[model samples]
Target: MAEGFLRHLAGDRFDVASAGTDPVGLNPGAVEAMKEVGVDIARQESKKVDRFLGQRFDYVITVCDRAKEACPTFPWAQSLLHWSFDDPAAAEGRAEERRAVFRRVRDEIAQRIRRFMARERKANKDPAQ
Candidate 1:
């Protein structure tokens, strides 16, 4: 969801990709939640962090506590950040209840992405930052 929001909000200004320590494939609830807000993430794959180990990135961010602990270090990245969000996919309940959790997390991720973008923009404007 973070990847979807970042891609949607940043457009071509940033290149974004997301992977997990344990790749469980994309969740249907996530796809539905993103679609509610006009972002289509159905095409995004559930990748393993290993796939990106050889690549360099400007920022390496982890969106969950478990991933933050298990994720390998990207020492070359300019910024390494963690945004601890609940794993909505882990939410247990009926269909609508699970969808509600997805929606809540989706909104939280969107808000965080907007804040991150604002800070990035400000930093770009101020060389000292």
Candidate 2:
């Protein structure tokens, strides 16, 4: 999800990267959902947050509440934001039901990213206006 969003903003002034504590690899359901919206994530590999520890980030965002709770403090991070979303991979029931969950999660993440991009653009344009 984060990868798709970041790809949308790639080559811009902001630097974006995503990693998970467990790093269980990209969910197939997530890959399909993003593909529905024209974003391909099949090549992306899940990485451990530790891989980014020494780097600097203007904002470190956690897309899951549990991750936010479990993540250790990063002294170099200028800010941390928690944008919790339901874990679509955890969805159960029929196959169709599971796909629905993934679709909903994908849409939610896309909406949040769009809003964030809009605000970022506005902030860049106005600065203090």
Clashes of each: 0, 0
Candidate 2 worst ten-residue window by lDDT? 5-14
Off by over 4 Å in 1: 126-129
**Maximum-lDDT candidate:** 1
Residue 34 lDDT in model 1? 97
Residues 61-97, candidate 2: write the lDDT tens digits. Answer: 8999889887877889987878989999999999899
Please provide, for model 1 over 1-129, each residue's C-alpha lDDT reduced to its tens digit, 9 standing for 90 to 100. Answer: 999999988888888889999999999999999999999999999999999986889999999999999999998788899999999989999999999999999999999999998899897895542
Question: In model 2, which runs have C-alpha deviations exceeding 4 angstroms?
Answer: 9-11, 126-129
* TM-score (C-alpha, index-matched) for candidate 1: 0.94
Local distance difference test, per candidate? Answer: 0.92, 0.83
Every model: Cα RMSD to truth: 2.6, 2.6
Model 2 RMSD vs true structure? 2.6
